[model samples]
Target: MASFLDIIKRHLALSIWAFSIIAGILLSQTSIDFRAGVSRLAMNSLYLPFTSFSRTYHLLRDRRVENLRLKEELTTSKLRVEALKEAQRENERLRRLIGFSEKIEYSNLLAEVIGRGTPRMPGSLVVGAGSDRGVIVGLPVIDENGLVGKVIAVNDRSCVIQPLNDPNFKISAIDARSRINGIVSSNSRGKIIMENVPADADIRRGDAVLSSGLGGLFPEGLLIGRVGRVSVPQSGLFMTVEIDPAALLDRLEEVFILFVGIAGEGESGVEPPEAQ
Candidate 1:
């Protein structure tokens, strides 16, 4: 699996956006049906191996989780206490998922994660839901842990997500404890950070960060991550804030896409490209 991942990282780093533009331009005169056929073939060729790997990884993960649950059932009193704590945490997560669903003005649709993109686009994820299921570009995608990414490209059968960790991604965020606001984005090296924060702000390690919904692009109060490190720059007025994402993004097997969008912003996302 390590070698496989290395191969993908080394050889499959080209962005889909680049592919779309090039295909669209070169095949501008092609019939729509013809282009669609080519797009499907290309998408399958590019992503099928990754999909199989993702499923295998998740199967092992599920087995580990099941083993932990079984072991808890046979444990001593102290271990039983740990089991209870774990149950409570799970209950809280369920309650949070319910609350999140209700708070949204639009409906949610669950979709399976099929693949990942890397190298030039490390944060790209491909999901097995698309236009046929009413998914479009700019829809917010989340899992129980919170915001994961947004739908960026879609066809009849699948779509690609650009997660929060992507270098091209940014959102308005606030410290839940301090109520101080900043823009959350990835730095040059792909680490998530909350920028434009005041040097003297009341942020601390472990402070919960959430989407502020100030820009109207993303909904409010979704957990982005927890604050990690706080440091002041030598010659800058604002401090640097590192953040840890709320979700195990690399392990995501499913996600929920909200049907809401800023009308024209999504526009059915970019359609799969035509072939020459």
Candidate 2:
């Protein structure tokens, strides 16, 4: 019984002493070169696996961050491309307007579209220029395509334009092909109706319509619209004609108001000035 326990306690101190002696003999080498080689080999063996794992983890983290950064840059580039396209379209529109304005014979006031009229009445717009820009009632407003409307009301900074689709708007126009005269007016149905055309008139579809200078409001030769459908009822003496206005009113964003110059003559066939 004292046999097994006493034997282990006696051997434990001896085991520790033997280990220390062997370690001291290895550390106290005869040559410094031998010791340096052993230390290098031990350190490499101990740290190689840990160092490799650390490098792999950092590489993965950096790759993830770079992917996120690339995605954000791609999104921003798409937005910038869209913005550039919109700007190009606007520039083209302005260029066309400038060329159109140069050929007209009246003093012009350029106005930016501020607001649109109620959607229920499509074709009308509010402009930023009004009396302050010399815009007055009955002034003809036109875009690059053709006549858009006339000024119906004016304030200091803004005015309301009555589009050609309005019932109160009328322009004397002539068929460019046949030279037949008629009045282009809008009905309550939002259709432009050409009146005063004779039943036997030779007007046809696709005939260009131009302002006839019959009214003192619109300038002569300004494009008005094109004749669409021409009908002659059995008992009717006048032809029923439909016209499509030349202006793209629904997409209008800018307009030029025509001011009657002091030296500009009144529209052809207008009455002379009355005595004051």
Candidate 3:
């Protein structure tokens, strides 16, 4: 019985193949419209899904690339903004210095501080201006707030300034409030110590000290420092006063060299000498 069924199945498959072949031959003899319609249907069914998948993948990849590019641009923009803000702050500080310098009416030659002296000679600094810019020895150097130092040596394009903390640098100063006079000099402990103040002087802490113009080096009334502490030692006849300099020596970057004009009647307020 199984052998009879197997034979029937094989005959059925052969009959189907013979019938399809006959159908194809008949179709080939027909018009071109039928072939065109079959080809179009096959293309739409087989190629459409593959083409759509490829286009979608490329679109997603392009969007990811665009997002990464935008993020990088934003980071660069933020860094540029920070740099610009720092520059603006620096410019404002310089402008404030310039305005303060002009208000003092002191003839000023601006210069940048290039280097600091060695630790053994910590009371001196090197500046970028020198004799070529009218910088001379004994000229007072100051910053926006007050006196910084004085030029002790001058070269072609640079000068050395001896700060107020130098042992040899002394200035005649008067109390801003009480008008008490004293001599300010540097102590061995790297401090400005005021001496020669009378025992009965009314000098107090926090009093501002200004140049008295007794020493021909510094002009009159230039700010020096404020008195920090005052003490009357048991062995000393004078009051020992400590001063805190107005200029921030550690942070110095720029300074103004004061230039005293020649004797004249107009701007400088001095009359010229008569012909000899």
TM of each candidate vs. truth: 0.58, 0.74, 0.69
Error of 1 at 145 (Å): 0.4
Task: State residue 24's C-alpha deviation in candidate 2, in Å.
Answer: 29
lDDT, model 1:
0.82
- The segments of candidate 1 whose C-alpha lies over 4 angstroms from its true place after superposition are 1-106, 118-122, 263-276
Report the backbone clash tally of model 1. 0
> Candidate 1 at residue 35, lDDT?
86
Q: RMSD per prediction, one decimal?
A: 32.0, 9.1, 10.6
- How high is the CA lDDT of each candidate model? 0.82, 0.81, 0.82
Candidate 3 Cα errors over 4 Å, as ranges:
1-68, 118-120, 261-276
- Predicted candidate 2 versus true structure: per-residue lDDT over 160-219, tens digit per residue: 898988888888889998999999999878899899999999999999999887755677
Report residue 271 deviation for candidate 1 (angstroms). 21
* Candidate 3, 1-276: lDDT as tens digits: 998678768798887787799998999988899889887888788777877887899998999999999999999999999999999987898898788778867667778999899465666899998777777677788998798988888898899999988888888888989998889989988899888998778988999999887755677788899999889877767888999999888899899887754223123522212310
Candidate 2, residue 57: lDDT: 91
For every model in order, what is the number of clashing pairs?
0, 0, 1
- Candidate 1 lDDT tens digits, 84-125: 999998678667667766765556776788989845566699
Clashes of 3: 1
